[model samples]
Target chain A: MNARLYSVVFTFVLTTIFVLCLAGINALASGTIEKNEQLEFQRSLVYVFNIAEDIDSISDEKILSLYGNRIEEITGDQTVYVVNKDGSKELAFAVQSPGLWGTITALVAFNEGGTKITGIDFVSHSETPGLGGRIDEVLFKEQFRGERISSDPSARVAVVSGQDTDSKEDARVDAITGATRTSESVQILLNKAINSVLPVVREVVE
Target chain B: MAESKKTVFLANIWKNNPVIVQILGICSALAVTNNLTNTLIMGVGLIFVTAFSSLTISALRRMIPKNVRMMVQVLIIATYVIILDIVLKAYLPSISKALGPYVGLIITNCIIMGRAEAFAQSHGSVLSFLDGVSAGIGYSLVLLAVAFIRELLGFGTVFGVRVMPGGFTPWVIMIMAPSAFFILGAIIWIARTPIVKKK
Candidate 1:
């Protein structure tokens, strides 16, 4: 065989074998990966709804059960998860906004009257970890549990940096230090969600 | 013609340390060192990729045409990295999420390719594997040291456990990438000062 031809043949043959092996491995694990994602989304829904306690320690089975029993899925322009709390209906929906690197997807829940936020959980984000990504930390998300939404709609929830957020009803959360751009992005995202998405979803639920 | 296994392994760890000596794979070292847990996982992932890729490259060195050896080495390295990624996603979803794109970026780390070109191309499979693993260990040792300081001061924690008292205020700069630059530079200077003096 010609040396050049041999080089081409060897490279082609090696690539085929490796790709086939990767395909086989991916096929084997795709099911489990999908299940993990589904379970994670269910976990986020459960967390945002605040239906169960000790979310981090809560078992996967418990999350699934809580999601299955208490949540109602309404699919439309925006998918909403509704859970009835003490005879009043609370609604949660996934919202997307631009972040430092890419889109930030958050599951945000509203109180029965939509006047205050019940809870918030970050579903997915591409922010830089340890800085912008601190949004996923319990310390940050926990502040949204009972924050009131401003009626002006221009700024429903404020993510102010270096500010004291002592009260839940203040409708403000302190941004991660040294992450000014990401903090600003979060504020913009909240305003968009409040001004555009919330009223439309509220009408649909009603 | 083959180098002794101990010399090959130990040299990569200190004498020719990938991060400090060769200066390869500094990108991931800086990116993942803000936290201990993430840095550890990244280290393990690199070790697995490098070791397997080196072994495979060494075994196929004779068969791979000289003109296409680099391409063949990359293909092998990328395959191992993809396998590591798939396995992480299936078994350790949360850590997988934490590491994010860094896992996939392992293919471009340069340490594996450096091993393939400088050592694996001429070495036997076992020795090449040892070289790859030691290089990874050397890289990990430096990264973990940096992470220890960063996580301690930045988060007032070690491996996510709150070690400092409640009133301890964390150092905000330690949580960012520029801090890694300063720490890694200091580490390189301290590790190399003796070597430079002896020479």
Candidate 2:
């Protein structure tokens, strides 16, 4: 056999064997991975709503009993996962925005009047670990809870450095020290979430 | 024979460490070392991929044609990495999520490729597997050391538990990739001093 022909046959055989093995493993694990994703999403939803107990302890049956019907998919936008909190008074949705390194996807919950943040949770981010990534810290996220957005269109939530923002009603947050870019990105994402998604959600719920 | 196996295994852990000495897989070291928990998972995942892929490639080396051996080696390595990714996602979703694209990036890790090319291609399956495991362990040890310093200085925590007393200001630079470079350079310098002196 020619060396080149032998190499081709050998490569083909090796690739087929490798692919078959990976496909088998993937098939076996896919169901479990899907279930885990669904559970994680549900858990994040629960967290954004401030349902602090063990999400696993709350059964799927219970979730269905609580906010299962409240979950609705917008026709054109798949990025938004809206959870209606009865009428048009409160809602939560997932938003994605570019972070310092990559995309930061977060779940932001807002009051029915669209004038305040009820809660927030980072769904995913690719920010630098330990630095900008600290934006995902619970302490940082907790600051957004009950933060009132200024009703004036000219006003935007400001993420300022070295500011005293202990008051959640102030519509401002002290940026995580040294993570100004990530904090700024979060502020931009918050504004986009409020301006674009909230009105659509308000219409559907109201 | 037993002595040779031991030598091959021990060599990678110290004299030929994949991180400090060889500097093969430093990308994930910088990316995942911010937190101890994520670093631990990443280390374990790398160990599994390197060990199993080495075993598989070494087992098939005899029949693999020289002309296409590198291609075959990569295919085998990629398969094991994907398997690791899937398993982690299924069994350890939180860690998997934390790891994110880093797991897929394992396929591109030069350590795995270097081991396949240098050790596994010429060695018997069992010996190559040991070599791979040792190399992975070597990488993990250095990464954990780096992660320890980074997490402590950056977050004032170890494995997410606050250890520093109040008023201890965290060093912002310690959490960034540049810090990993400095820490890793210092580690490599310290680790290589004795090796260089012996020569």
Candidate 3:
């Protein structure tokens, strides 16, 4: 009985020590980690704006300076980021849709007119790597640039296949060859973002 | 008794590799191996979690009640994995984003649990710590090897730099998960030959 009690006490003490050590390490790294996340968000914002400069080459201070209080968050039924470029407004909003494996969350930036996609960046996703995951790659994302949303309320952005996108003026993106499901999800997400969030922003901006 | 520590360390790397020999952690091995850098970071992260968790569990082995042992073990492992996830998100946001949900999935990795139950439970704290590190290194080495093959063939590159000749056409299939299944199977086959022969 004495031996068993001793064993129990020993285990309790050891587990306590382990937990404390991990807590200490986490505390130490917490500040740097937070700063990195902020910087990354800033970088993503810059990319959506089609800023040609290198994101990392510029310091966080510079990114913050460029941002220059131009960004605002809407507090309402849905959260949206409002960025003013001169008198015109650009609104960045988050959209979530199901991918092949799991949910995908993206930050989509649209011009005030809601006619053009200013920029887009994936905030989070769980798509299959090297296939569905290529949506996060710059080359795939670049296709969305300057895409004009069709004015017809009934018509949505169509992700087409095996066709040359000669008409950049149309808001049609060529879906990735092998990632039909993931590409379809992106189209669905954009449709939701445009229909639901764009109307809200249009009211605020107009 | 002294030699036992040395044997445990060596055994994890070759005779009982967690990925190749035991065939654990195949999911991340397939998912992240498309890029060398992500694969390396994932391996390092796993090593850190496995090593420290082993040390902690081994030290507490005597006191934890047998009835509640698995629960406590999971709790302990989860805490460390969360710490790893937080640190990565804070410091290496890009890599962290690339890694996605796999970092969280480390808690469910069988190797960490296997080590805690099989080795840490029976061993002293110091020996168990070494065993954990050995197991992690063993896992990392095999993953790196698989990553090397996958990245090179899939992208025609190493560590994201283009390496194939100008005229070379990259194999698109190499980038997919099915390719990893084939490559890993080949590796397991080759690795098991000597062991089978010796037996």
Write the residue-wise lDDT of candidate 1 on A5-92 in tens digits: 9999999999999999999999999999999999999999898888888888999999988998999998999988899998999998
Query: How much lDDT does candidate 2 score?
Result: 0.82
In order, the TM-score of chain B in each prediction is: 0.98, 0.96, 0.96
The worst-scoring run of ten residues by lDDT in candidate 3 chain A lies at A150-159
DockQ of prediction 1: 0.83
The pairs that clash in candidate 2 are A89-A112, A90-A112
- lDDT at B104 for candidate 2? 95
Docking class of 3: acceptable
lDDT of 2 by residue, B17-105 (tens): 88877878988888888788999888998899999989998998888898778888788888888888888899988788788889999
Error in Å for residue B166 of model 2: 5.4
Instruction: Give me the TM-scores for chain A across all models, comma-separated.
Output: 0.95, 0.84, 0.85
lDDT of each: 0.91, 0.82, 0.81
Of the two candidates 1 and 2, the one with more favorable lDDT, higher being better, is 1
Model 3 Cα shift for residue B73 (angstroms): 2.8
- Candidate 2 accuracy as TM-score: 0.86
Order the numbered candidates by lDDT, best leading: 1, 2, 3
